[model samples]
Target chain A: MNDLVENVVKGDIRAVARLIRDIDDGIPGVREALKALYPHTGKAYVLGITGSPGVGKSTLVDQMVSHLRRKEKTVGVLAVDPTSPFSGGAILGDRVRMQRHSLDEGVFIRSMATRGHFGGLTQSTRSAIDVLDAMGKDYIIVETVGVGQDEVDVVKSAHTTVIVVIPGMGDDIQAIKAGILEVGDIFVINKADREGSDKTLSDLRLMIDMDQKKYEDGGWKPPIVKAQAVFDKGVEEVLEEVEKHRAYLLETQGEIDFRRSPKRVREELMDLVKNRVIEEVLGKLTETGDFDAAVEAIARGEKDPYSACDELVLPRLEIH
Target chain B: MTGKRRIRIMVAKPGLDGHDRGARIIARAYRDAGYEVVYTGLHQTPEEIVEAAIQEDVDMIGLSSLAGAHNYLFPRTVELLKEKGADDIVVCGGGIIPDEDIPTLKAAGIREIFTPGTPLDVIVKWVADNVEPRGEY
Candidate 1:
């Protein structure tokens, strides 16, 4: 462990931010930093917030962050936005909306761009969450862009997933596909003061009741929270429901450990293996000049890709 | 060894400067130039600006100050970054700075000061040419 890693584990604010920056840039020494800080993590409760773009997810997160802070729990927020594939430019305006916590030392807010990383999060977001966890934040909230099914990946990394829904929007409930519904541990009908709030609330309840498999492993029903986050209405009850869901998850330890954690761990391990295999094989091939020869042969029609891989690639790899 | 990565600049409004029209315009211009820009909202202190710059690991800090407090806020931001071993982060300022104060700000380590009517192309070109990430990526 280096001095910087040690400082990060000790909750040094500057060091924590610098370490996250390095990780985001894919700079060297981050592996060692993660290794040193890993033991200090797993203490923070992670919450995932997802919804449609106009559902005011940012406002809900801001209110939740304030609620957590008032309860004396330190909070860390990761607001993820999608990067423009054509321009590589992103307007990370979530921070502008959450300016209330900008000056609060107990709150740390960061905006991340999904630069080619799928599931509405950057490749560095998980690492940033770990860094925040190690930095001693009691609650870490990951707010996704919440556009499509791919954004559900945020739930895999969280202990609780809050899906925000707005009332009075045409075809609102139809947007909640099966994938999003399965991952939702709690449903929030924000903008509850709107005209069609009752219809949306009843609609969500009927769907949840019909989908029996979502609660098959346990008898816990996902609570429907009615919140007008803009006016700071019913946010406390929403927080209470979140806490209730957390308690339910704690009681169902077998499900969490066997079903959730194992799947997440396997995904992480596979990611590492895939990256390492690419790095090793490509690096060896480049060093030995076989890669170029294979490319040239394929271009010249002298060798097929299958033959090239069998002869040149298979001989060097030790996969079993 | 940045290696042709996107140049990220943090455009921050430090102190009580409520005039953010210039900063917002510059941010949009930089974005149109295909640079990633993180605009820290109004009323940011020097410490908060430095912290955000470090956290975002941006190539440059574009500070906008129109309240005649650049002497203290801008230098304090630079000083905090230096103290945190991030002196490599470029510091630039704009908005309402007088000509006489320009040399003093430069001496205090502001890379460039864009006053009123400074062309957007000049600022964009300066950042693209001068601001480089020090990270070993």
Candidate 2:
């Protein structure tokens, strides 16, 4: 077990892969490994790619990885797909498009299933990113499962979130109403060869113009790049934009700890606390049969849910 | 975090065969059986398949080939896994393999071969009975 931590820190691929699997499986004692790995993280730049299904996210990621490799950067990719809600199973096919890099020693590509997690990513996805970071990857690209109007969780963990959209399919309305649109560090019009490309481009431009005025105090404006990922065109421009965004964040933030900014750290800490409290408290309640009893009381109208919740929780609180 | 561990399998098509209908159906079958399936699209070499399997840390690799290249592709996949010290990953073959080739393939470390008309449930059940999730966790 100790050797697993050491080998992961030493960048052994097999060990790294094993640790990631263990993390995904919720194997016992992984917390210690994560604790050992915590300090080694924050070195890799995390880039998030998210969009609707069949928008060419995987292909674009494949191209971007190749371009980054050409610049001599080691890359780790985590591509997520949805799980079957009924069967508790998943078909993780995102790695299929990125198989070209499977044999590259400097590139590690992993496919993840949402596995009942909402917001386009799973809890294990975050831990897997840390594993890749500790394994010495210079850049980590997290590809969320094809998301919809919301599911903006990617922005919390990514330094640069690139939202990909195709030329048509009424995405203009989607962009207008989506919480996802607000989180893009960059927007991509992939499949730009199709018709209505000009219309889509104009719509996005108008929307950005309207939105940028609010942040016009020397803030970064998200650039829109036209791309045909399958033909390998405009990928270099996308990479260039990613680099520019990185430089912009570092310059504007006035620190090298953009990945560990105060806001992000606070969120991470709170999330850890929330998950632990839920696990411990809920486990105890369920084990003691109090949880079922409370549920039965609520179902029978003997106790309101709010009062039952407080009754169950207030005693457990350490009121200092 | 408290969920049961699920079996992960990679269904890969090695060699130049693009007839992936069999692979696709089997992948869906595995998914419906409540297993996580990573379907590596078409035209993957043995090296690519093995590397992907190890990276994914999957318990099994179901190789599909209709181009009559299973004789070389299946064993080569097993060999590469062995060379990478990942032979603990079970390797199974499907698609158009003849009865005569079964003994040689199994001798070469291919665990089981399911030829045409073999039911998907049988294959899934074989996997459930034969393979456990790999690693100490």
Measured by TM-score, the strongest candidate is: 2
Mark the 10 consecutive residues where model 2 chain B has the least summed lDDT: B1-10
How many steric clashes between backbone atoms does each model show?
0, 0
Q: Which regions in candidate 2 have their CA more than 4 angstroms from the true location?
A: A117-122, A148-150, A171-176, A288-320
The numbered model that scores best in lDDT is: 2
TM for every model, in the order presented, reads 0.84, 0.94
Model 1 residue A155 distance off true place after TM-score fit, in angstroms: 1.6
Residue B5 deviation, candidate 1, in Å? 6.4
Mind sharing the TM-score for model 1? Answer: 0.84
Cα lDDT for residue A140, model 2?
A: 95
Q: Write the per-residue lDDT of candidate 1 for residues A163-197, one digit (tens) a residue.
A: 89988864756866667877888899999888999
lDDT for B97 (candidate 2): 87
